[model samples]
Structure formats: structure tokens, C-alpha cells
Target: MYQSSTIINHIANFTSQRNTELLAFSLLKSVNSMISCLSTKIITVNKKGEVRDHLFFENNHCTVKDNSIEIDNVLRRSFEHMHDSSLAALTLKTKAGYSVIRLLHHDRKSEQFLIINLNEKMTKENDYILSGILSIYSNFIQLLNESQTDELTGLANRKTFDSAISSVFNTRPREHKEVDSERRSPNEIIVKENHKYWLVIIDIDDFKSVNDRFGHLYGDEILIHLAQIIRSNFRNEDLQFRFGGEEFVILLSADNQMECMQILERFRRNVEEYQFPNLDTVTVSIGVVELKKETFHITSIDYADQALYKSKKSGKNQITFFENMLSQGIAKKSDIQGGSVDFF
Candidate 1:
């Protein structure tokens, strides 16, 4: 009974190895069709531990080629159990003669291996050919990933921004190069879902003072904290940037000028309400504008800047939306007031 069970197990193992070798051979045949001249076979060891999947291509009247000199140094090392089946070109001292060997492991168990012996020689040219073929497509894939991020924030940077805002402003029919308006013009681009995008420029209020009082360490901590807030408040597609020192810019694709203004105001209110160590509260003033696709010039950036300046000039820790072109005029309160916008 014991001998019968062992024999059955051996047969099962042989069948499994043969099946795997057949699959490997089919795959290699497909590969061979693409290459100029190639021959492949899978020499899997059977349950008896002899070659299982057997296919040999040669002129008939063949005896197993057995000549130590003809089969020279190849496959100097046996495969280690720890590794998956791998690829290698091997030359071995065979009974027949020196032949080209490509070793492929069949299974994780290392229970099966494949050795393909070719009647021809494999020069160094063949070894490096496949790698060169692969790199052409790989490099472009790497570049595409780099385009979307600000090197600093790892956030959607400028070029990524160009693509994002184009969705709302419209990617086609682009013509405006100088028009600046109350809403989006030729320069500014806003992504409006139901409405157009609103651009917001946020500056850390009296950030220099924070730097002076607590040192750059604390200043950076504040900056990082504010960045976290920015990340949390916005969606993944909302573009944010560390535009410059103590300044950040964000584009929300879905909101209108009023909605954008309210959003910034809420951020200001949140900052004012939070207490910090060795600090009372920190506030940021923001400027907002709707990006106008038509008649929008690239100079919309400058308009957003002017509005940001107005917020700083009028009072710190407040939200100011761009009305229109500053030359045409950006809206301002009748008088520049002192003190803060009371926390809301």
C-alpha cells in the first residue's frame, strides 16, 4: 500500500512538471516568433528526478551528445532554494558538446527547473540587446510623474495647474493674452464646476514678526501647520502652492467669487480661534479672484498679487476678493482700518 501511494505521488509530480514545461514552451515559441533566430525548450526534472518535459530538435540518428570538451564551462552554480525561477544564459559541458543554456526556474518550490540547450553559441551582443529595447518607453513614464508636483510641496505645481484650470477655462478656443477683469480674464484661469474657479492668495499675517519673536524654527512650525490646514481644507485636485515666502496660493475649481471669499474667511476664522504655544493666535489674509477664460490674459497673476497686497494693506488676517483689474480698480473698503477682523 505504501509503495503504491509513493508511485502515485511520483506520477502526479511528473504530470505537473510536464504541464508547466508545456506552458513555458508555448510562451517561448511566441517569443521566438518575434526574434530573428531562437530555439527554446523546457527540461524539467521529473518525479524520478530525471528530465521530465522532453523535446529535442536535431537531425535524426541522434545519440545523446556526450563530449566533455564540446560541452564546456556553463551553469557553474546550482540554483539556490530561496529564489524564484530566474533567467540566465548557461553553457555547460554536455555529453554531446558545448551548447547554449538558458536556465529558467519553474516554481517557487524549486521543485522544477528548465534548461534549454541550443546548438548555437550566444555572443555578448545577445546578452545586452533586450535591456536596450525596454528603456525607450520607461524613461517617458518617469517624466510624466514629475510634471504634476511642486518640487517643494509635492503638491500640484504649476504645469499640473495649467492642466487642472484648463478644465474650467476651456482647453480650446484659447486666445486672450492680456485682458484682466473682475472675474477670470485672459491671464487668470479658474475651474468652475457649476460656476467658475476663484483664485485665493493667502499671506501669513505679520509672519516676519513671528520669525523675529520666536525664531525660524517656530516660524517653520507655523508654516507647516498652516500647510496642513491648507491640505485638509481643500480637495485633492484643488491646486495649492508655497508661492513664496510666507505666502500660499490656491485654486478651487468649483466655487464662485463669493463662495471662494467665504472659504478664505472661514480659514481666517479657524486660524484666529486656535491657540498656539508662546503665541496667541496667527491669522492669514487672503485675496480672491474668479478666473475668466475669455478676455483673460496671463497678467491675471499680477491682479491676484495686487488684491493680496490690498488685504495686507487694509488689515492683516482678513479675506479680500479681487473686484476687477487694479487699473480699472480692485475693490477696497472706503477706509483702511486698524486692528484685526474680529474672529468669526
Candidate 2:
């Protein structure tokens, strides 16, 4: 059995991890080590009670694909029960094992469920201790989300981008693991040799004109709506950020240059087709650069920015690849270095 002091110290260490996913995994591992009686998992579910991502500490783990039938049935029952009465905590026998489920957090829009597969039936004292641990974990997650998420769009903020990009460069491509299966296929996974990371900077075309023509309140609505479109167009595993002031950033993994170009082109076309209320056609300019482990981080960002500048100069609503720009003799290395380069 773990002492109270030991559990507190372990949770304190969990709060120091770099990102939300890492923090969640670390917390689960710590809890499993401290209390061997229960194996914990954190599952993210959408408004319709569909299991989106499942994180676990187990062997031969069941994923959304592998257990879709069972998961859907379970979620259906849970939701039905939730409608009748509050399901703050409940226990039942599942196909896999005996489990306890708790509503870690919920709003009108989304919910996160905490599922514990019990190794043993708990005593009264054990239940009390487990409840306390869940509260601690919940509070930690709330604070982390508040810090890392953008208030307006709910996308990742700039600080998260800084840490995520640095970690990507420093760590070998092999170190990045696969996320949920619903997001991407096995072929699209990020592996060091096969797939390379690409950075794309997206700028809203004539955004300032829109802000001037309409009120700032409507301008903010456009920003939020565009953010939603960006999220829908990219995979869940991809890193996205509202880099500030109508400029956004996307980091994606692709097998080749053509694939990268195709992806960006698709997004561009989607943005062009979407209609915005009481507004003229809205468009975007994109600059893309293939990120290499050997390249300086700031240089890569600058290259992407330069490509964006080139896109703006040539036309407002096109995608430009940095390597293509070099081949076309449109930009020189000195020109990229000359641009304002700053990091946070």
C-alpha cells in the first residue's frame, strides 16, 4: 500500500510533465503503481457518447476499432442511465472485466469518463482513498487545460506550440508514437525515415479589411468559425495552433512532398467553398516547409513565413512550398534570414 505522502509526491511529479496526454499517461501509471487493485483508463467521449480516444495501462489493450460494438453498447446504456439520473459514479460487470465509471468532467458540449477496471472489490477505506485521488487528478487536468487552451477557439495556444515544436525537433521521429486510431491510418503514422513533419502557416486573406468593414464582434466570429474549419480539415493527431491575429499554424506528417501539397490544397479549396454569413468570399494564403531534424527550429519557421510572404506577393489565395520557391528562384537564403525571427 502507498502512503499518503507518497501518492501526493507522485501526483506532484505528474503536474510537471510537458503536455496533457503525457500528464494523463503519467498519472495513470502512477496510480497503477500505487494501488495495484485497480487499473485506470481515461477515455474521451463526444456529445453523442461515442468513444473518441481511449488511453490505458494494459496489455493487448482494446481500441475503439477492436471494441466498437461493446463500447457502443456500454456507452448507450450509460447515456440512457445518465438521462434518468446523475451518473457521478457507478460500478458494473463489463465484458472485459468489472469496472467503475466516473464523470470526471462534463459540459453541455463534451464529456470525459474515468473508467477503472478493478482487480479486486474495494473496501470502504479503499473507496475513500480512490475518490480523493480522482479529485486530485481532476483538479490538475482543469488547471492544465486552462493554461494550454486558447479561450476563444479552444485550440492549443502559442505556448503549447513552442514546447511541442521544440520537443519534436529534439526527439527523433521514431520517438513520436501513434495516437488514437480514429484520427489516422497505420500508413499515415509518423515514423522518422518514412514520413517527415511539415509546418504550414495559414493567414486569412484581407482579414484586416473584414475587421474594418464589420464590427470586431463579427470579426471574432469569423476567426472562431475558421478555426472550426481548420480543425475539421486536419487529423486529430496533427498539431494545430491559433498563432495569433488571423494567422494559424499546422504541423502534419506526410510520406512525400506531393502528399503534403495535396493536403494543403484540399484545405484551401474547402475554405474557398465554405460560405460565411453577410461576408464576401473569405480565403487564405499558406506557406509550407518540410521540417528536418537537422534544421534550426527558427530557420524552419522563417522559411515557412517567407513562403507565406511569397504567396501573398504573388497572389492572396494560393499555397506555396518553400522548396518550390527556392527551385523557382523566388527566394534566397539571405532573404529568409533577413526576416524578423523571434521565438517564445
Candidate 3:
């Protein structure tokens, strides 16, 4: 029999978490406590239905197992049983035990699954309880996504930028040996050793003029179109944000300035080539800086802003690197005593 008080406590624990990763752990803990299971896992898959990452909890402790082949096999089997209309959850009898897999959430970006391993098949009572827990988890995830997302573009908003960069700052630089295994997919471009996090600021050039000439409705359409272009050009792992009104920010990993330049330049060229409604052409100016552990977020943004100022001053539709500007004596360190730097 499930204790009402215990279930209430579990709901409270998972709901209290703000971070998605922490929330996932709490959800797993709650499941483990409520069910008589050998192991539990939360597997995340991309839109293509390939496993992106997973968290495995077994024997009351979290662990990592390099068993991709086994995971793939299990997924393949699960897919086979997914079409059974009467089966609320996919149940498979494996060599180790019986496993129950249920869809926790699904969206345009990704899908999440909850898998529980038990010595015996899950009872209907357990399945009912599990459905309740999944409902709560799914609702929490939807709320979190709405809170972090931009209303206009549907990209992440400025509110998420600080925490996202903090995650980058806290990550230890991976070694050469780790790079190969760290890659999520063969097509992933940003996975490399000795790579650094890059902070990019993209501004729509003369966007105010666009609003003046074509009206705010057309201008909004352009922003939405540009956001779609961004989603297509960058990998899903990269952090893309709409920082309000014609300004956007991206945090990505790259081996060096050259690679970063290639990536950004390609984006710039794409923006230039794309035709917008009632406009002949639309272009963007970008400023980029390397995100360092020692640098404050504001300082990093200021540095990129300085390069952006140069780009707007010289000409529109150009890319500028803060390090390049500094080396060329075109830009200097932001002086707090001089007051805040203004963007044009």
C-alpha cells in the first residue's frame, strides 16, 4: 500500500527544484522510494528519437554505465511494443528482469522516458500510481519551459543566460582523450578538446529603420524568421537566447577563434541572403568574446558590446571579435569609472 504522506512528500521534493537536472534526480528518487524496483532511469531523446543522454539510478545510488549498445537494443525493443493500444506502458522481459518504459514528456525539441526495472512485472496499481507521478512531472516541465522561454521568438530569454553561462564556467576543460567519447553524434560540430566557451551577441542591423519603413508587424515577422534560421543553423546543445528587441545571444563551444568565426560568419551570410517580407535584404552585426572563468558575466557582455559598437560604427552587417579588436588597439577594457558603455 502507498502511503499518502510519503507520496505528498515526494511531490513536494521534485516540485521544489528549479533546475531541470536536479528536478530529474528528485523525480527518480521519488520513483525509487515509491516502487519496489531494482533500478530506474530517465532517458532523454532528440527529435530523431536517438538517445541524447540518460541518468541511471541503481541500488540507491546514481551511477554511469557505458553501455550504449545495450541501451540501443532496449530502445529498439521498446519501439516495437509502442503501437499496442492496450499497453499503457511498454513492458519487456529482459535477461536481468522485467522493465517498464513510459513516455514522461514529448515536445518539438525532445522526448523523455522513464524506465523502471523490477524483478516481477509491474502491477496495474503501480502503473496507475506511475501515471500520476508522470502527470506531475510533465506539468512541472511545461511550467519550467514557459518560464524560461521568450514569448515572441520561442527561444530562451535573457533570464536563462546567467545560469547557462555559470554551467559553462563550472565545467572543467576536457582533455584530448575525452573529446572522442564526449561527442553526442558524428554531426556535432562543437565537441572538441581544448575548446572554449564563446559568448556571441547578434544585433539586427538598422532594425529600428525596418520598423520605421515596414511597420512593427513586418519587423516582428523578421525577428521570428531569424529565430527559425538560428534554430536550423546551430546544434540543439548550443544555448540561444533572445535578449529583447533585435538583440540575441548565443553561447557555444569551439576549438578557437577561427572556428568560432567560421560558425558566426556562416550565420551572418545566411541572414544576409534570406529575404524578409517587404524588404529587399536584412543583415546582422555580431560581436563575440571568449567566456573565461575569471571574467564576470557583465564584463564579458561589455567586451562583446564594445566590439559590436565598432561594427555598427564602421559598417553594418559585419562580424567583430573582442580579442581581435583588443589586439588591434581598436577596443580597450571597459572602465567602470567611465560609466556604462552604450550600444547604438
The digit string of per-residue lDDT tens for model 1 on 250-302 reads 87665455666666767788878767667888888877766665423244455
lDDT scores of the candidates, listed in order: 0.51, 0.73, 0.77
lDDT measured at residue 27 in model 2 versus the true structure, 0 to 100:
59
Worst 10 residues of 3 by lDDT: 174-183
Candidate that beats the other on TM-score, 1 or 3, i.e. the better one: 3
Clashing pairs in 2: none
Best-performing candidate as measured by lDDT: 3
lDDT of 3 by residue, 23-115 (tens): 676778778888889899888766555666677776565543222413676575574456335244687888888988887776677667788
Worst 10 residues of 1 by lDDT: 60-69
Please report how far candidate 2 places residue 140 from its true position, in Å: 1.7
Q: For candidate 3, what is the total of clashing residue pairs?
A: 0
Of 1 and 2, which scores higher on TM-score?
2
